[model samples]
Target: MGEFFETYRPQLIYALIVVLSVLLLRFLTNLLYKWLLKQELKKYPNEKPKAVNWVKRILNALWLVLGVIALSSLIVNEDKYDILKHNFKLILYLGILSIVTIVGAASANLWFRVSINRKIQNAEDPTSFKFLRYIAVFGIYITGILFALLAFPSLEGIAKTALGGAGVIALIAGVASQEALSNLVGGVFIISFKPFIIGDIIKVTDTMVGTVVDITLRHTVIRNFENKMIVIPNAIINKEKLVNYNLGELKICERIEIGVAYDSNIDLAKKIMQEEAQKHPLILDNRSPTDILNGNPVVRVSVTSLNDSSVTIRAWAWARNYSEAFDMRCELLEAIKKRFDNEGIEIPFPYRTVVLKKEKETHKNHDAGQTAE
Candidate 1:
């Protein structure tokens, strides 16, 4: 027992130092990450999510790197154990190569994630870049895992039957996950032909309303005007009715329907409407900058509905801004009411005529006889 312990003492110390180094590095990296995140949050107030994700992934990668380096060094020092000294050089090389490769892949993924997000921050379409990010991460992880698996000593069997069986097993596994394969293919289609992007208002159906907040392999994410998020399957979005506000001009039409008593002059009413519309500061007043005598001006009036008591004239104007449109509509309506009242024009209310049947002679006689009695 003494001899065995004596031989293993140096190896045990190396193992202990490796473990301690990795743990210490992990703690330090986490501390640094939080500090950096706080600093970034102060600079870019709206970049909390990006900063948080960046710091987290980078810290994890740093810890992974430290762990891999410690393990590689420890594995190389197995010679000092006095019993493992005569092992082939292949073991040491393999250990170092394997550890270095995994660390490299993780480092690449971290770099890609950070760099891509930076580019995306400046893009008109951030969702496309997000798809690229997913691809980068998946590629790195899968390549690393494949390399790790192939490096396993058991996979190097000399039997041809075993190699053939492994291939067959892989094929079977691939076939069994048909839906997963379809999702992967669908993700590719979605990225290549982007129907929508983040921050774009989209309508998928009659009721699903929101902005495209995120997209993933199996699902697309949407956040409604109420700040509620909904996850829809990619397959559904691929086949549903979708309208993208990102691709079109943002001009929205504000409409007003007004009517006046038939006795009022229609020309004067139209003139008053045109005057009210032009007074608002938000209305675009320039049609040609110079009026042509015969040229029909851009008339905002449309006598749309003809009701019994009044003729409903619809007035519409376009505004370049969405948030300002509703307020403009309200102002225009108040202006119209004040102008109409000033001009002695009444907005007619819905009216009806009641026709009473004529009383018969026999009823009149009965009433006269009662009075005489």
Candidate 2:
């Protein structure tokens, strides 16, 4: 055992040195990464510093390369060491390329998010900016991959072969990624057409009512009234019929429908509804200059239908946005109901009349028996 230890002392020493060097580099890299991340968080409290993660990843790769190089230099023969050294340089080049690409992507993404947040705060449209950000990030990743393939000597032949078979590869990829490509195209169409921007309240289906929160290349995110996020693929959402509450006009005309007893005064009911809607804070005066001049009412209340048990009165209440409109309508409903109760106007339930045919037949048979007796 003593002879073995003596003979292999140089190899053991080399291994220990390589391990320590890698550990030291990793420790330093982690410390630097954590410090940078802390500073970044201080600068942007809401944002996660993704670039630090990229830095850490690249530095780890660098330590790995250094360890391999140290090991080769100390333990391997001269010929093998030279070959390993050449490979080390390639690895170093690739590592640097990766770091640049990943860091640039992360930095650009962060910048875009920050810019979009500012736009949102300023009440500006961020739909185009968000779309462009996704496109730019995707393009950067693709370009990096292509450059890496072209720059590496060993991958050059493979890249050339792939290019030569571009047509076949495209055909195969098109078939395999048809849905993904459709979603991408759908996302482009949505951004270009501007059906619904972020912050717009849209009803995609009867049950899928929400505000558009985010639109990405693959999907759109909606935050519903319940505060739950619903992720729908771009293609599916684009194909579905949706009602955009903020498309052309931000103001919404909410129909506040109420039913009162048939005996209730129709004019009084209409006046109560109009007055209740007009007094709400969120209610908007959507009357135009001509309308005001023509003496049009701010809140228009009309008798829509006279049902069997009650009269259905509807008031058109305008609000600046969907959220305000919803809140306004709810408050108006409660207020109007209380006002109607105080004014001696009753909201009637659906009255139903039922006749029993068996009871009528029994009475007729008893009358026939009495007449016979």
Candidate 3:
């Protein structure tokens, strides 16, 4: 045990120092973070938590860096230890690599998170924010990894060779990641064109109808009415059909179709349809009577079709948004159904009147008599 202690005295002491230093650092950092938060709170009264979180992230990254540096200083002194004399370069390089890796990863995560928060706070469309942030973080860490590799003299030649083949490597990567590149480009186009922003109700496909929750370089995320998230690739979205309900205006035209018996009062049905639609709270009533006469109103009822079974009464109503329009349509349909039932107006179903043939009946009667005899 004595021999073991003697042999590992420097390492054991270094380990103890690192542990103590980390504990002290954390304590100091917490105090500093709180102090900074207090200062930020004074400047940003409404956003104290956000400001504090940002400060805390920065401090956490700094703390990691300081810990690594302090640990390296304790071990790298030539006069203090002969254990690292022969392998000093290798140990130092490894230490530097570890420090860089930790700092790079932590800072990238913190900074990108801050960026995303800022975008959200500014009411910016964040469809591409996550993807762009990830790309930035990946690039930063890849660069850090390359820089760390340079710390080893043995890997310097390999690094130089890689740099020399940069063009060929890029071409290979371009070919291999063709779909990814297309998606990246598609994301940029989507952001630029502003086809649909975050929170817009979009119909990617008949089944994929939902509110756009996010836009990323690779895909667009949608939160459906069922509360399920649907992720569609940006490349595919660009190629496929997309309907943006939030485009142009916040008001939407809702159409409700109802089938009434042909014998029922058509004029009364139209009036009932119009009244039912106008009663809904979601229906927009900004347009004047003049607008209604000019074929634009909160509610309008017309006979759209005359089928063999029934007359189709179409009710058109305006609503504040897509969701409101849907609700208004549903309410109007229910109200119309109840009013029709109460007023004794029949909703028609398909039917055919049967007429018996006299000659066929006589032949059947004669055949029955012959069988009986």
| Total residue pair clashes for candidate 2 | 0
Tell me the tens digit of each residue's lDDT in model 1 across 45-71.
Answer: 554344345445655565565455555
TM-score of each: 0.53, 0.75, 0.65
| Candidate 1 local lDDT, residue 216 | 77
lDDT of 1: 0.66
Query: For model 2, which pairs clash?
Result: none
- Which 10-residue window in model 1 sums to the lowest lDDT? 82-91
Candidate achieving the largest lDDT: 2
Worst 10 residues of 3 by lDDT: 83-92
Give lDDT tens digits, candidate 2, residues 213-294.
Answer: 9999999999999999999999999999999988888888899999999888989989989988888889899999999999
Candidate 1 Cα outliers beyond 4 Å, as residue runs: 1-109, 120-124, 144-187, 205-207, 254-273, 285-299, 307-312, 321-373
List residue ranges in candidate 3 displaced over 4 A: 1-95, 122-124, 127-129, 145-175, 286-297, 350-373
Better of 2 and 3 by lDDT: 2
